[model samples]
Target: MFFSLIFSLCCVTAWALPQYQPQYYSFSPTVGRGHGESFASVGEGRITGVRIWEQSNSYIKGFQLKYENVWTPIYGSTSNEETELLLFEGEAIVQISGKYNPPNYIYCLRFVTSRGRSLIAGQPTGNSFNFYPVDGQSELQIVSGRSDGTGIASIGAHWALIYRNDSKALT
Candidate 1:
């Protein structure tokens, strides 16, 4: 009887516990687009996992990666049906709902879709975004600096990745 109780407790604890997710992170508008670069700047230390939401033809699609926070492409081969349930598993560094670029810091991520369309997420018509609708676009990119192209390091056009964060450690 005690052994069974212990087993049940362990199962409950595992299901109830929360996973490790970054407290601060940004999403790249470029994710989910056909093929383009979008940079989302995140603090060197605060970023742990980045979930770049993919968009195509005005529809939110599948996820690029489960847990990753680097200015790189979180490539994932998925279908278009995933758009209705756009999400990042567990917790992540940032949620790229669309068009919401972080100031002074960007988190660049690569994204592309089988369908070619100009992807733009977020409430372009309204302020204070509460959600990102299903949409598709050609490409998207999250910047690491100001909203406008001004001050901030760059590799040229956009996107700068040093390596893949497999361990999910912050810099």
Candidate 2:
């Protein structure tokens, strides 16, 4: 009976646990100005991860992610790093707008997936931001202008996407 109980508990634990297969995607590199705006789209799926990268010494002040018409704000400082999320799905729009110190810093946004592979919709360039749609995914837009206040400046920007084969399927 003890052996049976142990087996049952193990089975329950396994069933309740979730499998993580991490995938990542990013927007193309572009120059951002103070108060300038950049937009990228997260394909339809479960978003289990997020990350921000500042290729240069400059930093981004603030940003936002819009999903289903809800705006989720993300703030940054002198350091560029990654941020984790529980699980988010549906269509997402990332809008990064803020001041970039040093005027010509480089930056990029990365999105990780929990299940299924990431479809790369853009590629990074040294001087320009280009979108290379995969699976017919939408293009990422990085614009320079004032959204809330005076825009900041950046040297370049890029997008990267990562996909894992072992992640659980998105429901």
Candidate 3:
């Protein structure tokens, strides 16, 4: 009787407590040829800057992202004109849209932030594609894709809720 009473109390307590569901990241469909070459800039911290190298009136040649104070290695080779965007405090990238060419190569990229600011690079040619979080509560967290030796071949985005150093939610 004692053991049954204890077991019943435990089960009731467990069932009464609130269940916390784990948050999973949502991935946007990758766009472009997606050759074997690969690169990833995952969640290190808040994104602080973005630099894109592109041929004049042509495709994206290289890309780099700054996480917190660190910069990821350049994906693809760096040559020709380069465009850079430095984000302000608490700003987050909320949308990504671009164009991809046949065979390979990302033709253009436009990044929109939560503050309504934007950064655009490359030429607006090729097929159009867009990426953003469907969960509404998440922001851009991971940028992964393939890059040919000379230019970006494909790109994908991952979105998740932002967390502070204390593990508190920021978004």
Candidate 4:
């Protein structure tokens, strides 16, 4: 009887304690129109590089992400200039900042990595936004958003740890 009482108390105590929930992912609020468009880099692999096509003095035209060795299809149209950022081993994107005009159109973007390296593109001329991991233990795992045929109209980011595989490590 005493053991049963003790077990009940233990169960109650445990139940009353805060549950530890592991965060698998966190998402930054979608910035821009975020309509009629979608792209995701999640579940493909770790992001090894970023490519942004931008019209000089204007909005971001399109972008693509390199997952390990493979590059995803560009989300928008190619433009006058293209900027690419390659991430070093053990590095991950931790922050993304950008500007978006009213209605639609992402004007500029900046990607900051864990190693303090940053890649900036497009023309900075609109409402500004900053995105980072909410849990602080995650990195950029997914890049999804909307794009008009001509340019990027909206964007969002998902944060989480990438699945590790030594063979697929970036060159």
TM-score, each model? 0.20, 0.27, 0.86, 0.81
lDDT of 1: 0.29
How do the residues 61-101 of candidate 4 rate in per-residue lDDT, one tens digit apiece?
99888877889888888976999999988777889999999
Most TM-score-accurate candidate? 3
Better of 1 and 4 by lDDT: 4
RMSD of each: 17.1, 13.1, 3.0, 4.0
lDDT of 4: 0.84
- Write one digit per residue (lDDT tens) for candidate 3, span 56-90: 88899988888888898888878769889988777
**Model 4's TM-score against the true structure:** 0.81
What tens-digit string does per-residue lDDT give for candidate 1 at 1-171? 999999999999999999884322223333222232324433332223333333332222223322134433333323332322222322122223233232221223222222221223212321122222122211122323222222111211122232335563211
The lDDT values for all models are 0.29, 0.35, 0.85, 0.84
> Where does model 1 exceed 4 Å of error?
27-171
In candidate 3, list every pair of residues with a backbone clash: none
Question: Which sections of candidate 2 miss by over 4 Å?
Answer: 22-30, 36-126, 131-171
Lowest summed lDDT over 10 consecutive residues: which window, candidate 3? Answer: 162-171
* Ranking, lDDT, top scorer first: 3, 4, 2, 1
Worst 10 residues of 2 by lDDT: 143-152
* Most accurate candidate by lDDT: 3
Misplaced by over 4 Å in model 3 are 1-4, 7-18, 22-24, 165-171
